[model samples]
Each structure stands twice: as C-alpha cells, then as structure tokens.
Target: MEWKGRRQSDNIEDQRGAGPSMGGSNPFGRGSGGGFRIPMGGARRAGGGMSIGTIIFLVVIYFVLKMMGIDLLQVMGEGGQTSQPGFEQTETASRRSSAQEEETKAFMATVLAETEDTWSGIFKAAGETYEEPKMVLFSGSVKSACGFASAASGPFYCPGDHKLYLDMSFFDELANKFDAAGDFAQAYVVAHEVGHHVQNLTGILPRFNQQRQRMSEVEANQMSVRVELQADCYAGIWGKYTEQKGLLESGDLEEALNAATQIGDDTLQKRMQGYVVPESFNHGTSEQRRRWFKRGFDSGRLDACNTFQGDI
Candidate 1:
C-alpha cells in the first residue's frame, strides 16, 4: 500500500502512555472544567453537609460526564487533573517511539482517512451523512466506554463511544506471530474495525446487541460470526475503493487475503489449541472469511456484504 504523503485523519486520539486510569475529557467540545454546573441548593445542611438537591445535582453531573467519555469521579480521585498528566506522558511516549513506530502511526492515520473518505462518499450517495469515528491509540491498557481493555484484547470498536481502540504493538504480533506481514494486512485490520463502526452507524450493531440479549450462548456466537464476517466484507469494500484509487500495489491484495485467512476462527483455533470448535466459532472459517471479502471486493455493493440474510 502506498499511503505516504496522503491525507491523514485528524480524529486520532494518541493516548499511547496514558494508561487505564487516565480518562481524558471529551476531544470534541466538552471542555475541561468548564464550570457550567447547576446550583440546585445554594446553602449547606445544618451539619456542614450537602443538601439533598445538591447531592442530586452532583449525581446528575457525574452521569452526564460519564456519557461524554469523561469519568468525573475518576478524575476527582486523581486530584481533579485529567489532561495534564496524561498529555505529558503521551507526549513523552511519542518522543520515545522509534522511527518505525511513528511511521506505523502515520500509516494508521492515513488508512483511517481513507475509510472516512470512502464511507463518507458512500453515505452521501445514499442521501445520508457519515459521522466519522475516532481512533484511540494506547499502550498497555485503556479505559473506554465499553470498559477496561488490555492490549491483549487486540483492536476493537466500541459502539458505546463511537471510537476504535487500537494498540500499535498488535501489528508486530500480526507479523511475527500470525505471519501476516505487510502494510496492506495492517490496513485490513484497521479497516475491519472501521467496518464495525459502519455497522454501528447503520443500526445493524444496535439491533444485534438488542437481539443478543435474548439469545442463547450458542445462538449469540452464531450471530456474532455473521457480525464479524459482515465487517470483513465491509473491509473488502474499502479495499475495493482503495484499489480503484490506485493505492494498492503488487501483492497488496494478496496480503489482505492472507490476513483474513490467518485470523479466521478456524485457523486461529487450530494454531492456538490444535483443534477447532464449530459452535464457538464467532468469526467464521477461513474459507468463509475469504469468500465474503472477495464478494465485497468483486461487487463493491453494500447489498453484497449482508451476512445476515441466509447461510453466511
């Protein structure tokens, strides 16, 4: 993939060294300590305690901040300082990142920009507006609206916050452990997560989440396979757009296909535990993944990527 000097996304939140405890304020207009609180009660109680209305107001504020991706209680526990420490640590970590890691970050940003452009165009053509999702880069562990996650959890999209969380170190694992080397493979990973964001925007993810509440464990796993495979197909749609733009070079398509194959549920299960359990397979088999991706790549149609219509 030739991504150098291309447009990069400004929606990336580099929280690389901020760790799980450092939940920063909202990146989009929710200012830090803006002092716009409702004074429900101006006077304190007889014993120097807060009034009932004051306590209720504080509780409301807490929940509001939580919804905005800011853990106000956590911030108060950390001395009411959210951005300074995390910002300084992230800056130091960025300076410490090797040249290669910085390049990887740039590549991720470029790919994210590509997805934004591609999806925005598709949405606009359909008479809809695409709200681009943010990507959060972290090291070790991070706290998201979905809860706390470690780097070992791999890349994931959180519908609760409409953001994608990624650990750049996973690319090294993808190459060294999974043998899925190459930048296109890395782009596939990023695109796959963005695909989940697409699902969230389209109401597919919300519907699935609601329906899964009444499903059995086995049934939920089966449904999850469809969700994941649809994401793979969506990634292929992005790949098709990229190819049409002449961004893909020789062997790039193969790299993405190999990546889809390598990370398939069957392949990963066999490689990790020497066996495969079909019922527990939530990401489909290697053949299924490769086929769906090819379907999207060949057709380049949204309708071609629907995995929930039949036997997917």
Candidate 2:
C-alpha cells in the first residue's frame, strides 16, 4: 500500500490497446454447467495449424487416452494447448481519462515488482531459480492462455502460459464500483493472482484439475472456493513478509481485508443481481476470503496456508 519509487518488473507486457481474439473458450470455465463455448475467431497461429509431428503426436496420444477411457478432446481441451503470447492488432488509440488509469498502472508495476522480489527470494532460498512470470496489462479486452477475457473476469494467472493478465480498470471497479478503494486493496489483487502462480509451482494446479475431474458440480465449485481462499491466504503470506521487512503501514492490512470482502462472491452477486446464491460461489464467501487473508497475514508461513487440507 505504501509502495512508491520501488522496483518495477521488467516482465510487464503492456498490451493495453491491443484487441484480443480466441479459438476455443469455455464460458463457464470448462465444466461449470450450462456449457459455455467460446466463439471461434481467426487463427492466432498458436491455436491454428498444427505441425505434422504435432498432429501425429496428437493421434497417438488420442489412442492412448482412448485406451485409458478418457476423451482425447476433453483431455486436450482441459489441458489447454500452449500458445505463444502475442499482441493482436494495435489500434491507433491513446490514453484517455489519463489521471487515474496512468497512476494505477505505475502503482501496479511497482506492486508486481515487489511480488517478484518477494517470491523470487522465497524460491531461491529453496534452491530453485525463480522464473519471473510476465504480467500482461490490458485496458478493456485481453488474450491470455486461458482465453480472451474482458475486464470482468478480474485478474487471473493463466497456468498454460505462466503469465498473469490484468485489466487495470478493475482498480476503479474495485474502488468506486465495488467500494474497496485503497492502495493496499489493489496490491492484494496482484498478490492473489501471484498466489495462483505459487499454486502452479507447488503442484496445486494439477491436483485441482484432478479433483475437478472427479467432483460433482457443487463439490467442484466448493473446491474452487478452497483454491481461491488459499490464494487469499497466500496473499496474506506475502503481506506478512513485506510487513516484517518494514513495508506496511498501520492501516495497510485493513485495506487488504476490505478488498477481500469487497470482491466476495456473495457481495458481487448481490451487487450484480438482486440476491446471493451460495451454491454458485467459486471464489469463496466474504467471511472465508477475509479469514484466509488474515490467516496468511498473521502466520507469514506457507504451511499456515493449507486451505486445501484445512477448513476455510
């Protein structure tokens, strides 16, 4: 929250004005029921035109998957194919509503740098080199390994590409729109996504995929809630480390808590619709989110964030 004049990550890909397109997108995030399908667009070279070897490899793998009683299409679909990150057609657009957007971008860059520093050191201490993931900054729409997403998907870390995508306008959406306006609140957003990256590192992503495969609709949603809550806790872990390193002000932690509550599934649903549906929740409830974040903030240890094996 008190970040300024700090290091900025060189890994930021500023694709703010670039338009995005997708090949196959699951609107409900692949198996959320009602079957969401992404409309096809012109091939982005990444998803189109498989090489001969790639085709043969797919053919062989398909039979192997068939022998294992798995749908090759579903397997390939769930295990998203690797796509090269590229900016789509760049329009001749310039910055508008300059003040808030520009400043938030700078602040986001600084925050991302701090996360990189924190996570990189943590990984290095474990004797593994930390590969810094790229953060794509977009304005309205952006293409990611996950698919094409608008500002509405919030911030997400795409496991397929090991990069994080964000639409900076969400800061205002969080502040004026969601009533979670604070600098620390914004940092928490970035930290939560980075927490997803940590899950990727800890093999939690693969485990989640397996669980999702075996879960019922309601149970899978609950699993997703646990995953998201764990991310909130992981964000708190980052907060604790930063605080110990003399980086937090007195009210900073509260700012993050306010954020955790602001974007809670029930709160967001009520704001968007007229009521809350507990069964449809994927990111956890307000209490669960705030508690997990506070847990991480208090403990500062990754072991304390075993939201997968523990109660929310």
Candidate 3:
C-alpha cells in the first residue's frame, strides 16, 4: 500500500485523548466474563428485520470476539446512546500522537482520500453525486449519533451521523492478535466501513432495515450476512482502484484477503468458542467473504456487488 505523500482527508475528526462524555441514564450491563454485554433495552421493533439496537449489538459481537477475550458491548440508552454523563470530557494536556500513530493517521487519511476520489468518479458516472463521509479518530471511547462507543466496540459507520468511527489501536490488534498484518489489511477495514456508508447513500441500508423487520431471527441474520458480504465486495472495488493506480504491491491483495478470512464470522466464532454456528453468522463465512471480495475486485462494477440478489 503506497499511501505516503498522498492527500489526507480534512474530514477526520481527531477526538483522541478527549475523555468520554456522558449522554444518557441507562448503564451498561456487565457480562459474566467481566466485559459489558449490550443490553437490548430501549430497542424498538423495526418493520421486518432487526432493530437498530439488534444490528448494532450484533456488530458489537464481532468487536467483542477480537478484543483479546474481552466483552465491551453496553447499552447506554435509547438511540444507541453509548456512555453515561458526568465523566470528564477533556483532551489531555500533552496530547500527541506517537510516530507510528502519526504514520497510521497519514495512511488512513490517504486511503480515505482515495476512496473519496474513487467513489466520486463512480457516482458521477452513474449521474449521481458522491457525499464523502467523515471519519472520526478517537481513543478509549466517543459519542456519536449512533451512541457512545468504546474502542472495544471496534470501527463502525453510523448511518445516523454519516461518519466512520475508528480507534486506530485496532490496527495493532489486527496485526498482533488476529495475525492480519500489512497496511492493506488496515485499508480493507477502512474500506469496508466506508462501503457501509455507500449502502446508506444508495438507500440500501434503509431498505434493508425496513425489510429486516419482517424477518425471523435466522432470516434476519442471513440478511445481515448479505449486507456484510456486499460491503466486502465494495471494499474489493476500492482495492481494484488501488491496484489500477499502481498503489498495490505484490502481497497487498493477499493481505486483504487474509484479513477477510481472519474476521469471518465462522473463523472468529471457532477461535473464540471452539465451534461454529452457521445460523448465528451475520457476516459471511471465510470462503464467502473471500469470494465476494474477489467478485468485486474482478469486475469493479457496482452491479457485481449485488449479494442480496444471487446465491452468495
């Protein structure tokens, strides 16, 4: 991934070092493992699929599994409220990013810029305008329209606010714990979240939510798999752009592919629980993830990412 010297996004909101701010009254429930279990309180029934709470909770599970065996999902309040109020919300006096942190920040900014460019061109060709989403860089935890989230919550895109919330420390965890190293792997993560933003922009996410309300739990989980797989494909579409720009090296694609497999629902479940539950899988399996991404990479066409229509 040749990201240095590339343009960084000005949209990045640097909230690192700022302490968590309180937002609501509901507190997070503690899990037996000493981690927070996201309570499904204040969650309302959407039309056919999972509610926003259920969707966010399911996403939180992935972060929980990756967190060195810690559970961090918590229910803050209605509307995805994250943290309770009264905590100090101030930036550290000597706040400064380490050299590696600085480098990673630059890399992320470059990747974001590339995505903005690629998506803008894509939308223009389709007779539409691309609305680039902002990315929030925070440590510990931060608040969003979706609610408060700790670093353990992992990187997520809140359609409510049209921003990608990320904790750069997850990059280290991706390398050290998940064994998915390389800058491309990190880029894939960023791209995947941005892909969700794409879904939001295209109204796919809204439609999915509407359809999900009528689905059974198992059926809804299957739908969620489709959503996640499509994002993987979209990430691959971005990967295609990088490859075309001569930004990708020989092992770069492999790194992203490895990352796809590493974070597969089945892979994470098996590693964390020593077993796999197919029905519980929201994000696709390893082979499914790898294949969908390859599909997008091979075609570089938005139509190629229609995971909901075919036998994914």
Instruction: Give each model a TM-score.
Output: 0.76, 0.73, 0.75
Given candidate 1, what's the lDDT at residue 81?
A: 58
List the candidate 2 regions with Cα displacement exceeding 4 Å: 20-96
Model 3: number of backbone collisions: 11
Evaluate candidate 1 by giving its C-alpha RMSD to the native, one decimal. 16.6
Error of 2 at 156 (Å): 1.2
Q: Which regions of candidate 3 fall more than 4 Å away from where they truly are?
A: 20-97
Winner by lDDT between candidate 2 and candidate 1: 1
**Which pairs clash inside model 2?**
none
TM-score for candidate 3, residues paired by index:
0.75
Instruction: Please report, in order, the local distance difference test score of every candidate based on alpha carbons.
Output: 0.92, 0.84, 0.89
Would you give me the overall lDDT of model 3?
A: 0.89
User: Ten consecutive residues with minimal summed lDDT in candidate 2?
Assistant: 83-92
